[model samples]
Structures are given as C-alpha cells and as structure tokens.
Target: MSILPELERRFRRALAPVEEDPDPLLAMIRRSQDPKFGDYQANFAMALGKKLGRDPRQLAAEVAGRLSVDGFCQPPEVAGPGFINLRVRDDWIVDQLTAAIGDERLGVPAAAEPKTYVVDFSAPNVAKPMHVGHIRSTSIGDALARTLRFAGHRVVTDNHIGDWGTQFGMIIYGYRNFCDGEAYGQNPVGELSRLYQLVRRLIDYHAGKTRLAPLAEKLAGLESRLAEMHAEAAAEGKTGDKRVKKAIHRQQKDIDEAREELGELRAKLEAVEQDPELSKLAAEHPRIGQSVLGETSRLHAGDEENRRLWREFLPPCLAALGATYKRLGVAFDHTLGESFYHQRLRPIVEELIAAGIARESDGAVGIFFEGQDAPMLIRKKDGAFLYATTDLATLRYRVEAWQPDAILYVVDFRQSLHFENLFAAARRMGYERLELKHVSFGTVLGEDGRPFKTREGDAVGLESLLDEAVARARKIVEENDDAKPGGAELSPSQRARIAETVGIAALKYADLSQNRDSDYVFSYDKMLAMNGNTATYMQYAYARVRSIFAKGGVDAEALRASRPPIFLNTPAERDLALELLRFGEAVDYCLKDYRPNQLTSYLFELANCYSTFFENCPVLKAETPELRQSRLVLCDLTARTIQKGLGLLGIDVVEKM
Candidate 1:
C-alpha cells in the first residue's frame, strides 16, 4: 500500500465514532502540496468539527493523540484551523524500502478488480503512407495500453485502419492511367502514393475549373460593368440626375457581391495550385478529373478492374506502414480495417430503418434525434453506407467478440462530434452495455502554431522523420562521447545502434511527455536535448547508474536475484526511497485518466530524486559495510525502476549512452 492509503486508514479508525461522512474525511487525506507541510496532510478535523459544531483545533488534537502510528510516523501536527500534518518516521521509510526491494513489483500492487478494455487507435489509410500526423494516436494509444496492462488490465489494442474508402477509387484510376511499371514494381508504396497524389490533385483541379467557370465569367462581366459605372459616376459626380446615380449605386453593389464570390473561387484554385507538383501534374492532365468520377462510380459498383487494382495495392502499402510501427514499437492485437465491416453496413442501415430509429429524409436514410438539428446520416441518398454506419457495425462486432467493459477511440479532437453521434446511435440501436469513450488528442503543430507540415505544405512521412531524428541524434552522440580524438572506441555499427535507440526514444518520449489534450510544437533541438525532460536525459540517468555499478563491481542482477534488504540512513536516501516506492502509485495515477504525461512526470521526478541521492550519499565509500550495501540496493532499485517506468511509456533505454 502507498503512504496515502495507509495514513487514511489510520485517520478513518480515529474518526469512525464522530464522523459519518467518509468521502469528506477521505478527501481531507491528501499528499501535502509542499514538503514543509509534511509528507501528507489531513484536515479531517475541520470538516468533522463543522458537522459536530465543535472547535476544529480540539478535534485535530484528539485525532492526532488517538492515532496509533508509533513506528510509521512522527506525532501528527495540528496547525491553524485544525490542519493536521503527518510526517513519516525515518524507520518507516527504511521499512517500506526494504519491502519494495525484496518484492519484484517494487511494492506496486495489481488491480484487485481488473477490467477488459478495447483501445482503438493508429487508423492510417491503406494507400497513404503513415505521416507525422499519425504519431500522436499511435504513440499515445500504445502507451495507454501498456500502462493499463502493467496494472493488470486485459487490454485489447485495435488498429481501426482506413482500408475501404473513396480514395481507393482514385488510386485504381491513377494506377490504370499514370503508373510507371518499372518504378511501381520496385517500390509499390512509393509508386502507388505518387499515383494517388497525382490523381487526387487532378480531380480537385478539374472540379475547381468546372465549378468556377460560370462564376469566373460572371465576375468578368460584372467587372466590366463596374468599370463603366465607376467612370460614369466620376463624370456625373455632383450634377447627375437622381435616377442615374441610384442605378449606378445599385449596379456597383451587385458587382461587388459577384466579385466576392469570384475571389473566393479564385483563392481555392490558387491554394490547389500552390503545390508545384500538383500544379504541373494538373496542367499536364487536364482531363483526369472526369475519369476519377467514372472510376469512383465503377468501383462502388464493384468493377472488376478497380477491385483487382485495390487488391494489388493494399499489401505493399500495409507493409510499408508496418515498418514505421516497428520502429515506434507499436503493435495491435487486431488490425480490423474499414473494409472488414463492408458487408455488414447494408444490414445495419436496414435494421435501423426497420426499427423506426431511421427514416428517409428527402433521399437519404438517417437517424433523427429529438433535440438534434442534423440527423446522423447512415446512408447517402445513393444507396451507399456512411462512416457512421461502418462504426455502428464495428461496435456490434466488438461487443459480441470481446465484450469490453470500455471502448476507447483514440482519435483526433476534430472528430469529437462523430463519436458523440456514434455513441448516441449505438445506444439507440440497443447496444449499450459497453462504455464508449473518445480519447481525443490535439494536433501536432509546427513552430508557427499551425498544423505541422513541410514548407511545401505536405505532411512529412513518418519514415523520413525517424531517419532525420536518428541522424541528428547520432551526430550529437558522436560529438559528446568520450571516444579517442583520432577514433572512437565504439565501432560504427555500435554507435549507429545506440543512436537509433536514443533517436526513436527521443521522438516517442517527446510526444508522450506532453499533456495529451494540448497541441505541442515539434522541435528536434528541444526534444533531443541532453538536459531537461527528454529521453536523452532519462537514458543518460540510467547509464550513469549502470556506470556506477560497473566501476564499483556492484552486480545489480545478483542483487535483484538475491533480494537485498533496502534501508535508508540519510535524508537524501529517504527522499529517493520514497520516490522509488511510488512507482505503482504513479502507474495507477497514469491509467486513472489515461494520461501518459502523468507517468512521464513521475519518471522525471524519480530521476531528479535519484540524482540528489547519488550526489549526497557515498555508496562504495560508505562509513560501514552495511551502509554501503544499503546504498547499493537503492542504486539497483532505482535503475530497475527507471527501466520499468520507461518501458511502460513505450520507450527503451540502452545500458550506455
């Protein structure tokens, strides 16, 4: 048990006869905000005294005096307004450390009642390469799964990939039209992505022109009329008749509205033209747009040619995506893509309509809620099922298959409304046993506070980003290492491996360390720093501990195997001991709200505490053999705790850095 619970138990025993409301009393027992206020503070007396109409100071004194925490804590201090402060006894700290070191879990307990959870995340599209945009969902969801599993929950991770979508129709069209066989045969992902991009841009460009054609012509006519009106108004200035002046004003106003609409259309076209690649390709293939619509219609109608192309393209795209997931150490228990529920979509929509929850509105089949302004569209007017329909089918499959206590969709915050409507629809459809939660995350922004993208205005590829971070980390490791001036002691491959570990760790830690709800600016200089709360810093701390054991010939593995007794004999040692024992509490706290930053913060503080103890306490040169052994035990536990904590965060540490 942690210190807070133990203290609360003692307080409850003392307040049982007088206080009946346990929630308020429990709330009173919290970790002290400041160290000087003691390790934990209990203001239960003030709350109970108010109920009993007695002086709170007297009640505090009675409760402190009645407390039977002889060896565990010093006398509880009742300060102004009946604030009760309790400090753990040094011997109690030593006892807790001894228990923690002897146990494999380091005194962290598993959940007494574990729940089954299904976490859905990392939903990358089939044809599109994984990019920086995927980092948050993949990393954050993986960390939550790890943390929850560590706490003994049965977590099922699901990668709800985007496999069946209209984008595939564009891909099929592009492959049939624009693909280079030699290039595609060598690297299918590259060639398919290229074709997809080209076709998508061409389609968009042609659509812009067709839609804006009439507006453009209208604007031209309006501008000519406005020019004449401006000149006429200039000539008529103060002497023109009232009827001519009014007519000119009205005509000019009409021209202004037309110009505004035309300007918006031009801006849209300009934005599409901003991409040099898209601009060139669009100009080269001006007729590609109509072909996209034709292909899309054919694919939806189960065209054999499009189906064959989709089958040929999916394997390589998924293989390329798997490489990025491997580098990030993210894995899923099941990768059920959108196509998996394709057949069930029709049945689901028909059932909703039969059940009277859905009806035909004009041409579309949708569910209309009593208070909702817009109905949830399950089927478009054209006999096609929507995303919400697929999601509803997915819900039924998960319920019948896993029966999870909770289902968390780790999606971006932009789709918040979709989940709200989805959960509402699920409830309406009589599938209401499981909890549905949208674990929304903010966008990853660049330094300018806009969405993170390259200067060319395209998302950065995940593989390229990892490569760049690894190269930069390798350079830093090479420059700062203690290798010989002429040559390094480590081989090139060894350095490269270390750099890869550090680089990947840095990327994951940087993303996981931020509050999930806040958008963080991605920066290599800041995330890869050897100081501050970076993965490099955490790895270095672990390395320092390993180095100490190497220099002193302290066998940590032997210590752990033999289960040495841990005891703290100094202030710094006790502080470090307290932090080390809080590992389970930290993990529990992290999963309580599914926030990985809580775990990061705990690991960071533990590192700082270990640093303080390492500086103040002498291990190999202790005053006595017993003291030295105790300090060594602390070192071993600290190292193990760091590794375990970092591992839980989906980050790894090298023995040396």
Candidate 2:
C-alpha cells in the first residue's frame, strides 16, 4: 500500500513482457533522493540493455511508454543515462490521505503472505537479579515482536529464562552455608540475591588467588620479551623498519594487556583480604567453586533437599522478574524456562547419537563439524547435561508444537559460535526446512568505553537503572509543567504519571534508535534531550499536534467523519503528507531486516516534516473553512502516525509532555 511497493508492483508488470525474471530489475527502483528529480526513480534500463544488447536510452523510452501507472504517477520520463523519474500525482496523494484519515491502520495494508515466527530472547538467569546486560535483548526483542505483528506476521515471543543453571547452584550453596533466616523470611528474593553474590564473590576471590602466580609470571615474561624487542630494535637501528616497528608495537600491547590482567586479579584478592568477615569466609570455603558445582549436580540429580529448596526459591525469583518486566512494559506470549526441557534433554541427546549426528568425544557426547576444532558439547564426561543439550530439546519441542516457519534467537554476539554450531546441528537432525537466525547484538558500554558497570565492578541492576531514569525525568517534567505560560497546570499525581511515561519511553527509544549490531554508549542527558531523535522530542511533537486540536475546540473524530479533501497547497504540506503516507513503507523496511532502528529513523523524519509544516502552514488559521478543516485533518494524521510508530517501538507518548 506504500508508494514504493506499489510503484515496484507496477514496474514488475511492465517489465514482464521484456524479461523473464524482473525482480532484479525492479529492485533498482527507489525513492529519488532530491525532490527536483521526482518522487521515485528507476535505474534498471542500463542493466537491462546490457543484458539484451540494446541502447539503454532507447530501451528506457520503450519501457516508459509501456508502463501503466495512470492515477498513481505522471508518465515516466526517460532521463539521462537511461534513468526513469516518476512523480506521483497530487490527486493521488489527496485520495490516499482521505482514505487513511478514516482508517484505524492508516493506509498500511496487511501483508499478502504472513509467516509464523518464534522469537527467543531475554533469557536471564532467574537465580540472580536482572541487570543492565539484559536490557538490549528485552527491548530489542519486544520491539521486533510488536513491529512484526503490526506488519501482519504471526509472532510468538518466548522468554527462555535460565531457571536451571549453575547460578542456582551457587544460591543453594550460599543458603545452606550463609543464609540469614529472618532476612529470608522478610524478603526471600533479596536474601537469595545476597547469598548468590556472596558465594560468587568467594569463588572469584579463591580463583583469583590461585591464578595470581601464573598471571604474574606471564606478565613478567611479556615485559622481558618487550624489553628484548626494544633493545634489539635500538641496537640494530631497525626502529625505522616497518616490520620491526610493528613487532615492537604488538609486543607492547601484549605486555600492557598482561599487566592490566595482573593488576585486576591483585585488586580482587586485596578486596577480600581487607574485609575481615569476607577473609574468614574465604578461608573457611576455599573450595567454594567445586562445592557449588557439587550442589548443582545434586539438584540436577534430584536430591530431595536441593530439589525442595529449588522449588521454594523459584516463585520469589519469578515474581521479581515479573515486576521488572511489568515496569518495562514487556510481555511474552510464552515463558518456557530451561527447566521445562530438562526431562527431554537426555532423550534429545540419545536421539542425536542414534541419528549419527553426535558421537562420543573424550567420554562426552558432542556434534563434530568438518573444520571446527571444538565440537558442540551436549553432555559432559560426568553425565551432566549442558546448555547445548537443553537448547536442542527446546528446538525440537518448538518445531513439534508451534511448527513455526522461523525461530530467531536474540542474543549477544559472543555466542556466535554456539549458535553456528546449534543451527548446523539442527540441520543435521532434519530441521533443514525451518529458518534459523541469530540476531546478535553488541555490548552497552559506559562512557569509559568499557562494559557498563558500577564502581565495585558489579553490573548495574535493572531496577535501579529505571529508578534513576525516572527520577531524572520527573525533575524535567515538573520544571516544564511549572513553567507553562498560565502557571503550573499538572497536579503532583499527573506529574508523576507523565514522568513515568516519558522516562520509560526515553529508555526504550534510546536502545531502539541505535543500530542493533553496534555498541552504544549510554547517556541519560542525550537520551532525554528535548530535541533531536530522542523519545522526548517525538513525544513533544505529538503533543504539539494534539494541542492544535485542543486549542481550536475541534473534535478530531467529527473532522474525520466530515472527510475533508486534503490539499497540497504548499511544498511543506505536500512533504508532510508524503511522509505521513509512507508509514507502511517504514514498517516494511523494519521487518525486512529485523531492525527497529529503521522505524525510529522514519518516525524522526516524519517529525521533522511535521515541524516544517507547522512553521510554514497554519491549521486552525487557514484562509478558508475547508482549508482549515483539511489542515486539521493533516494535524490529526500526523499525531496518529507518530503515536502508532512509537507504539510499534514499545514506547508511549504523553499528551502534554
């Protein structure tokens, strides 16, 4: 229903008589970069002429003559170098606007062929508090699901939580050794989180202590090697030689990295040693790492006490996760945790072995690839099932139960090899027809260009992050509301409500606006700014449009009922209308590559176009009543488009931000 796709469809029909497969040629048609050229342009004639051995300009003229785009565009003009420029008709734009005004979905039509999709994302370990690392997966996955469904796809969002993992083992070990019963009774999840952290800290302390000697030796050897390289370079006067310089540079980098590693290990060890209580605990539990693993094995093996403890601990952990999801406005169609597939893990491994897809590798079961040095391990030598095993079981269950056309894993890029092997193994096990994709993303870095962390080097908690964003947003909201021309118009409760919406929208939009594969530095000031591509700007744009109707005492529904004729009297009006009508095209581009930033870019452009229109064209103050009604319709349409686009990105707009 968008202009480009409709143009492409017509081009496909016109090119059918000249070429057998016109898809490659049709792809050359795109929106013209400059308005002076036209609304859309096609540059396929040169390629087509090359293929058919004809003059490109002559071929373009012939193709343009044969094109049937009546009422949609002007007659195609064969420009220089066999380019075809087609400008849409003004009446066509008016007709589209009129139809969109009365339609709930605007002018965006349902997909002709929709497919079922299963989106797997946000698989945080429920035993620990959700942290900043989980934000990208949760936000990206939710936005993709919303956009795909709006684009007329059957989307199933599954939060495959990590319920049965080693983290739980650490929690169990900590509870047995260090739990405060009164604290647990008061706040089970909080106590469990504390215990998990305590056990993990002790394990890290011991591990660092054990690795301190080897790391120091490695650092010393690296420093010695670097000195030798420098001395050789200076003595031989080979410093100017590119190879010697490169070797020295590489050697220095290695030495620096080694020294940094050694320093971090020493710092961790010192922290534990300085804390009297922690030092005592570390001495008492020197083998915490192995002991935690033993507890995990017992739980997995159905030991009665560990099993009972797991059952008791799961509910509070789940409740905590649910509250966070609620705050973020994210929901999943199905939450199938790792424990759900435990019973089937063994059977899946046995089936893989029977099918010859897997074999014994050093007393462990794994799937080997032709060139891969390391096989995909499904079970350890000690008969403990691994994550890969559970993943295989989950894949089989989804295929059998949902019969989806595709399953997308929204995870970080570090697991690229794991997904590569998982997909390869799945194909070997007869899942060749299904679409398996790994939507990998990069890290969230702090201003220091490293992974975001607290002063203690711990991950920033998700709840605390939300709290800070809201607190900052509340301050902004109160200032703006109090500075209104007529005085403060919002009550405390209303101010609080608006602050929450803006704060959450700012957070979600900040992540959604970036290219999902690139690492982005987090900054509150930039994300919450009143201008640029921030959600605050878009929300303000929407509010500005709504204010036009409110001030005029106009009923938007009644105006739409009147169905006033849309007029593109000025360049600004026409540009705004064109951008408004291309909402469906933006959604299509977004789903084409599973990238939400595409939608964000489109919304930002639409906002800019509307701003231009507002500056140049008046709505309620138009010259005539009919013109006034038409402009009002444009304002309403702009507000609706902005709202719908932001909604698709899992953001809300304030009516008076």
Candidate 3:
C-alpha cells in the first residue's frame, strides 16, 4: 500500500534489462513538487542518459512507454528534462485506504532488519534542579526513542545522572557549614540551591577581587578626567564648540558606564562577604575552593560522612526532577549515575595503556589524536579521573552488557568536540563495529534571542516553566469557554485536566516542531496559539474531526467492520486521501533522519488538507451515500493518524478541546 515501494516495483519491472545494477536509479523516485505534474516523479532517465550519453528527454520517453503501472495509476507521462510523472487513479487510492483501515499500525511496515539502540539523554546533575536547558535533549531524545520503538527497534533509554561530581562537593560542604536545617526541611531544593549559591558566590568573590580593584581604580580616573574635561569645556564656551562638547559628552558616558560596572561588582562582593559563616571562613582560610576540592577528593575516595550527606541530598533533588518528568510524560529504562562507573575508571585507563592507545603526559593518562593540539585527558595528574574516562567506561559497559548496534548521545551542541574525541577513543578501544552518534541540539533562546529565562533574568526552572504554561493555557481555555455556548458548563476538574494536556502538549510540540540543529526562540504566546503549527492547532484539528463523526452519528466501529468503499470525488477529497495514505511514508522518512519535525510537518499538512476538504466537500450533506461514507472514513482515518503521530511525540490530543 506504500506508494514509494509500489512505484519502485513498477520502475524495477520497467527498467529490468536496461541497467546492469539494480539500485542505480534509487533516489530518483520521489514525491512531486508541483501538483501540475503527477503525484510522483522519477528523474532516473536523466541520470541514465548522462551515463549512456543519450538525450535525456528521449530516454524518458522510452522509459515512460515501458512503464507498467496501468490499474494503480493513469498513463505515465514524460515531462521536461526527462522527468516522468505518475498519478494514481481514485479507485486505487480507495482500495489502499480500505486495506489500511483495518490495520492498527495504519499500513506502516516495521523494519525488516531491526537494530538495537541505547539512547542516553536528559542528564541532570544529582543535586542540581532541572531547568530550561534540559528540555531540548530530554524531549527530543524521548521522541526519537518512541519513534524507533514504534518502528520495531529495540531501544534502551538511559538517564546518565550526574551523582558524583564537584557540585556534590559544594553541597556537602555548604550543608555542614552554612545550611539552615528548618529551611532545608521545608524546601530541600530551594535551600540546597541557596547553599550552593553561597559557596559559588564566595568562590566568585575571591576570584573577582583582583579584577574589581583595578576596575574601581580605572573608573575613578575616568570620572576625574571627565570632570576636568567638562570644566575646561565650560570655561572655553564649549557649548558652541561641537568637537570639544562631543568629546566631553563621550567621556562622561564612558565614566558613567565604568562607575555602574564597578558599583555592581563591589555590591556583589560585599553581599557574599556579608554572610557571617562565609565571612568567618574567608577570614580564617582565605581559600574555599581548595577546601571544597578536598571534600570532593574525599568523596571520590569513598568517605563515609560525605556519602551519607550525598544520600540525604539526592532524594529531594530527585523528587523535584521526577515531578517535572512526570508532567512531561518522560521515563527512562535505566537511571545510572556516574558513580556507578567509578570503580571501572582505573582498569579502563590501564587497558588503554596496555593497548597502546593511552599514554602518560605529565603524570596524566591521555589519548592523543594525530594533527590535534590537545589530548583528551582520561586521568588527571593528581590521579583523578575526568568525564572522558567515565564516558569510555560507560561505552564499554553498554556494549558488553547489551550488545547494542547503535548508541546515541543526546547532548548539548557545545560539547561537539568532546563527543568527537569520545567517539574516536571508543573506536580505538575496539568498538568499531558499533554505531555511535552524538545528536547535538542548540539552546532555547528567549524572545530577545538569548537563553530562555524569567523576566528577572534567572534561568527558568523546568517545573516552573510547565506550571506557567498550564496556567496560561487554562486561562485561554476558560476564556474560550465563557465566550462560546456551553463552555461555561465545563466543570473545574474537566477544565483543569484539559488545561494540563494542552499546556504540556504546547510545550513539547513547540520544541519538537523546530529543526533540532537550529537555535529557536521560545515564545509561549506564539506556541500555544489555536492556529498555525502549534500543538493546540493540531489538537483542535483532531477535535474537529471527532466532532464531525459525532454530528453525523457515524459509527466508526461499524464503519471499520463493514469495510466500505471510499470514493474520492473532488480535488480536495483526493488530496486528503493522498495525505492520509502517505502516513506510513512520513513515519519512515522521520525514522530515517531521526527528526520529529518531519512527522510534525506531515501531520500539519494532513490537517491542512482535511481543512480544505471540510470547507469544500460536505460530509453529512454529500451528493450521495457513497460520498458521505467515504468522507466520514477519511475524517476517522485522519483523526487516528493525528492521534498516533502526536502520541509518538509524547503529546496528547483532547476529545473536546
């Protein structure tokens, strides 16, 4: 029933003895760009003509004459520049839809040669809360995993939690020295964030002191120079002297900017030193980073007290993260932390050394690539292992434990070089047979084209962001309900559930509908709209389809059981049928590129086609019973396709939105 494969079959039969290789003209067959041309176009004749030094149009004519697609499609026509166009007959379109109507998978075929995939994504630090930065990787990775699973691939989802790291050191130190026990008992993450911030502020204060003193001195000198210039200009009647006045004005502006910066820097430093505990520690030790690192080193060495503190800090942080993931409907097959691979780091480094892939560079084990400046460090000079070392161990463990065919790391685009070295190192470690890929994504920018954040300029927390989205969506839904008939009658529970569904869908679809490699500005107002490519648009489209069935009193189950013949009478009806039938093709195309946007684009186009059909061809008031039944079937199929497509993106469609 898939058009591409059937056309390929006809093409293979047409050019059986013409070419020596079977797939020589393979990518030439594709959907037509213009509707004036037929449904599918084959540009094989042009390439074949180039090979044989024959006229392309003449070759196309011969190929068109020999094409054997009579019943499925009308006569094949050779167009300009050796493009052969083919259009399917209406009868064949209905036959395909009838056959596809009974299948749960909607006529999409599963992979004939399925491969196993281990997708690693949504990696949040153990005690650090999830924020807006985590959305792209988590949402995109989950969608790709679902697509692959639905396509019959064995997928293992892993959330590589950052449990053992320098951040934990800061937390342990802050809790012991500066924590408010009552505050932490009530809001663990909030109190923990405050503690972490205090430690970080202390570090920044000491580090910025040297720069701040110089800046303050420079600002004072600039202000003194500006005052002298202004006095000289005023004494010289500089109001009429444009050059002198301009110079004085510029000097004053520069002085003002410098003063502002110096003031802010000093204020921040003073605030950090205002904390009594940190001030006392600053006076006593003068260097807190070293102490934090000492605690980190002990934790690495398995200190009992640090371990207990870490255990205490992890639960509340995880609960906060779990709440966010639950709202987004994201789950993981494995939740392995970096601490799980701590025991294997040394052995991994030793194996690399024995295999001649790793060498000691200033007491640190490193892997160097030819023509590269820096060697990726596996072991630090102080006998500490880095993330590179743990990544290597994780790769080996995944391969040996699961024997996966492919492993995808959904990480930030900033770590391109890190993944490059990691993959190269994994290959050197004898994983050449495995397919390793780093699916890097860009940052979510705000309306101002910077990283998304609150109006207060703080990074948006993931849960807070979702909660805001739901609240905003609920207000819109309520507004709609009040403005329309029977909308005010919706109970509070129903409105609440609908708002949650719409809001989460809006957030997820807004992220998924964009090209993954490009930086997209996140705008809640634009993404949650009832029109365009937003999730609300698609949701409303599905609801409209359902409403059609309801108004017509059409029994979808009986219709499916009866297997009625679908007759495409008008241009809109045929276009809709074509779009619906290409659902399988769209899924295949999306799976191949690992781009959910492709599927989104397909569903959006399908919705557009449905809209056109609804406007032009009346379903309940059709000219004949056959036409009405056919349009009803089309509506049902389109709704099902939208539901299945959105579900793959981990989005839900409401029945009565």
Candidate 4:
C-alpha cells in the first residue's frame, strides 16, 4: 500500500481516542509542499483545538504522542501553528524499493473492492470525418480505461458513435444529388466525405446569407450601444467607478462578439460566391437545411432506399474509423453506435410517456425539469425522435447489458446541459443507484487561442493531424540520430519506427498532460520538445536509465535475481527512491478523480528525480561494489516505474529515444 493510506490509518487510530468523528480529519494528512518540512504534513491540530477550546500546540503534542509509526515513518515533529510533519524512514523506503524491483506491477496493489465501469467515449459522427475536437474525448477516455483496469477494475469501453445523426442525412442527400459514381466506386469513404462536406458547405452558405442582414444589424446596434456607454462614462466622469467601468467593458465585449460573428458570416458567404460551382449549388439548395432533415426523417422512419444507403455507407465509415483507432492505439470492447438503438428509441419514448416521466409539450414529447425554461425534447412535433430518445434507449440498454456500477460519458463541455438533463431524466426513470458522470473536457485551441481549425475554417482532420505530428517527429528523430556519438547507428527502418512511436506518444501526452476541464493551446514544438513534462522527456529518461545497463554490460535479470539491497546513500538517491515507492499512491490519486494529468504529473516528477539522481550519483563507478549494484537496482526501478506510468496513460515508451 502507499505511504499516505498507511499513515492515514495510523492517524485515524490516533485521533479516535481524542475526537468522536476523526474520519474527516484524516484528509489533513497530505504530502508536504516543501521536502524540508517533511514527506507529509498534518494540520488538523488547529481545527481540532479550535473545536475543543485547547491550545493547538498542546493538542498537537497529544496527537503526536498517540500516533504510532514505528516501521513506517520517523517520530512526528510538531512544527509551527501545530503542524505535524512526518517523514518516511529511509529504511522503509529502501525496503519498499527492494520489494518493488521483483514485482511486475511495481508494488502497486489492486483495489480491494473493484467495480465495473462503462466508459463511453470517442463518439464521432460516422458520416463526417473525425476532427481535432475528437482527440480530447478519445485520449482521455482511453487513458481512464487503461488506468482503471491497471488498478484492477472491470472496464467496458463503448464507442457510442454518431452513426444515425443528421450528418448521415447530409451525406444521403449529397449522394443522391451530387455524388460522382466513378469516384465513389474507387473510394467510397473519400467520395462520401466529399459529398458530406459539399452538402454542409451549401447549407452553411444559405444559412449565412439568410443571417447576414440580421447579424449586421445586431453588430450596428452593439456598436451604437458601446458608443452611448462611452459617451455617458466621459460626460459623467464615471470611468473610474467600478460599476460604470464594468458596464462599459460588457458593452465593448458585446460589440466585439457581434462584429466577429458578422465578419465570419460575410467571409463564409464570400467564399461560396467567389466559386462558380459552389455558388450555383448554394442557389440550387436554398432550403438545404430542411431538405437534410427531411432525408434524416425518412431514414429514421425506415425508408427502404435510405436504409440500404446507410448500410452501404456504414462499413466504409467504420473501417476508416478503425484505421484511425489503430494509429492512435485505442480500442473499444463494444462499438454500440446510435443506430444500434434505432428500433428501441420509439419504444423508449412511449415508455417514458407511460411512466409519466415525459409528456406532450406544444406537440412535442419532452421531459421537463424543475426551474428550467425548456424541456429536454425526446420527439419533435414532426413525429421524429431526437438524440435524447436515443440516449435514453442507449442508457437502458447498457444498464441491462453491462450492469455497470458507473457509466462515464467522455464528451466535450459543450454538451454539459444535455448530459445534465439526460442524467436527471434517467434518475426519474429509477436508475438512482448507478453513478452517471459526464467526463466533460475543454477544447483544443490553436496558438491563436481559437478552436484549432484549418485555414478554410474547417475542423482539422484527425488522420492529417497524426500525419503531421509523425512527420515532424521523423525529422527530429533523423536529425538526433545523425548527431549521435557513434555517427548515426540507427538504420532507416529503426529511425522510422522510433519516429512513429515518439510522434504518437507526443500527441497523446500533449492531450493527456492537460487538465481536462481547461482549454489548452496545442503546440507541436512544445509537446515534441525533449525537456520538461513532455512524453519525449519521460521516454528519454527511461532510455537514459537503460543506457547505463547497456554501457556497463549489466544483466538486469541477474541484478533482480540477486535481490541486492537498495541503499539511499545520497539525498538525490533518497528522493528518487522515495518517488519510486510512491508509484501506487500516484495511481490511486489519479483514479480518485479520473484525471490522467495527475499520473502525468507523477511520471514527470519521477523522471526529474531520476535525472537528479543520475547527475549527483555515479552508478557505474561507485566507491563500493555493493553501492554500485544498489544504484543499478534503483536505476532499473526508476525505468520500470516510468514505463508503467506512461503505459497507464496509454503512451508507449521506446527502449531508446
């Protein structure tokens, strides 16, 4: 077990004698911010003293007296303001490291009581191409699944693909109206993608043309309002007032947003108008929005021709998606797309109505929640089912099939309200015992701080993004290999293999390293760099440790088989050993909140500690043979921990990078 949990158990026992409810106080026993303070610190004395009307220092002394950490940590030292600092014994650290070297899981114990988890992620609309936006969900979800399983949980990964959405309708309409038969015969996926884009562009052009006048007027109104606000602020000399300044700031923001929207609409319309064929198509499909919806309605209503097209188009789309998944090294136990629940959607709506969970609101079937102006519509007035209906069916199917303790939807933050409503409705349907979570993540923004997109304002394709990362990585790999001490020892094929691994690792790490709730600027240069918290750095650290074994011709298997005693002689070695022993703790911390960044943070720290140890201590030329062997064992442990930690994040480490 990790030191924190063991320490917490001891502290809980110590606190039990003094307080009635000591469970909450255990949270105060956390890792110290500064190593000089100690390995861990507990500040519960102040709060407990305040509650009991006692001096904090005296209470800290009493608690310290009751605490027993004989083999685990040194004597608890009471610091300023009744803070209790506890550092793990160096012998205990050495003992743990010795035990870990022989274990495959690096001494990380499995969960005592594991539960089944159903992770829903990588849900791209099959009719459209996967884009940059899909990366967050896919990477985050895969990492979570990997981590959960490593921690000994039953994990079910389901890719709830958008196979039956309006995007397919757009494709269907485009195929009927504008598909090139020859091109489709050769490359169905390419042709279908082209058609989808063409239809979408025409729809957007018409939509933008219709909204241009109103958007321009809105911009003018916002500009006039901002000018009025500025004039008032100037005349009244209220610029210094906080409220007036706030109002003026709000006005300016409104004006800026309106102007930006108007500009985008104009630009979209201009692009189409400049192209003769596109302009003709735009003029021809003025009501493309409704027409697409009509096609979708027919598909859902079981039109024979539309169903045949859907079946024909689905395989190629799925195959293309499968290839991307293979490149990313992501897999799903089940790919239950939205189309799988088509037959159940209507019955689900009827069941909701029968259960009084849904009712007809203005000719539409919906479930209304308290304090909400709009209800979550399941069926539109035109007798067409909505995503909400399909979602309900999917949820029911999963519950019946998997019986998972928790269901996690790895999706973007934009769908927060939709999930909130869905979960609420699910609860009303009597699924109160299960945990339903929306693992919402933020956008991947370009360096310009907008959603990452192509020059033409379209979302960047996932395949092309991978290709670019790998291409860049290949260049860096070749350059580094050529600059090696032996003058390029790696063959072309070896370089290619390393480039592929490094490139994909960089991409996955770049996304996994960020706080999933915050938008991060995606930069290839930053992510691919060989220093700091990048995957390249971690991989290099692993490679550097392995190089010691290679240079000395040391047998790692014999080294482990000998069961050499690990000695933390230097402060650097001690820090590295301490970090190595905390691998299980790091994994536990990560799974606590479903955040892979926690694991990334831990791996980065481990790598840094290894670096410090490598610089301060010489493993091959120690004063004593025993110390040299001990440091070698430590080096092996560090490499194994890095490899395993990165593996948990769904990132691979090259033996040499």
Between candidates 3 and 4, the one scoring higher on lDDT is 4
Query: Candidate 3, TM-score vs. the true structure?
Result: 0.89
lDDT (C-alpha, whole model) for all candidates: 0.83, 0.91, 0.86, 0.91
Tens-place lDDT digits, model 2, residues 1-657: 589888888988889889999988988998799887798899999999999999999999998998999999998999898999999998999999989988989999988899999999998999989998999999999998998899888999999999998998999999999999999999999999999999999999989988999988888898888889888989999979999999988988988898888888888889999999999999999899999999998988999999999999999999999999998899999999999998998888998899899999899999999998999999999888899999999999999989999999999999999999999999998899999999888899898899999988999999998988898899999999889887897889888988998998888889989999999788878877756988888898899888888889999889899898888999999999999988998998898788999999999999999999999888888999989988998999999999999999888888786
| Candidate 3 lDDT, 506-548, residue by residue in tens | 9889988898889979988887775798888888889888887
Once fitted onto the true fold, the runs of candidate 3 whose alpha carbons sit more than 4 angstroms away are 22-24, 210-286, 454-457, 485-489
Check candidate 2 and list the clashing pairs.
none
Model 4 TM-score (2 dp): 0.95
The top-ranked prediction according to TM-score is 2
Task: Give the winner by TM-score: 2 or 4.
Answer: 2
lDDT of 2 at 140: 91
User: Which has the higher lDDT value, candidate number 1 or candidate number 3?
Assistant: 3
TM-score per model over all chains: 0.88, 0.97, 0.89, 0.95
Distance from true position, residue 322, model 4, in Å? 0.8
Answer with 1 or 2, whichever has the higher lDDT.
Answer: 2
How would you encode candidate 1's per-residue C-alpha lDDT over 1-657 as one tens digit per residue? 578667877887887777776766876687687899988888778778888899999988988888878888888899989989988887787777777766767778788899999999999997887889998998899999988888889999999998888778778878887889999988888998998877776776687788797877887887788678768767868337787778778877887888776776677579778978668877877877667767766766778877787788888888988888888888899999988888888898888889998899979998887788899898998788889898999999998899899999999999998999999888887767778999888998988898899875579888898998899999988876656454555667878989999999999999999988988899878887757888787788888788779879887767766655566767788888888767887887788688899999989989998888878998889888777888888888888888889999898988766
Q: Please state the error at residue 175 of candidate 4 in Å.
A: 1.6
Q: Assess the local accuracy of residue 558 in candidate 3 as a C-alpha lDDT between 0 and 100.
A: 94
Which pairs of residues collide in candidate 1? none
- Candidate 4's displacement at residue 586, Å, is 1.0
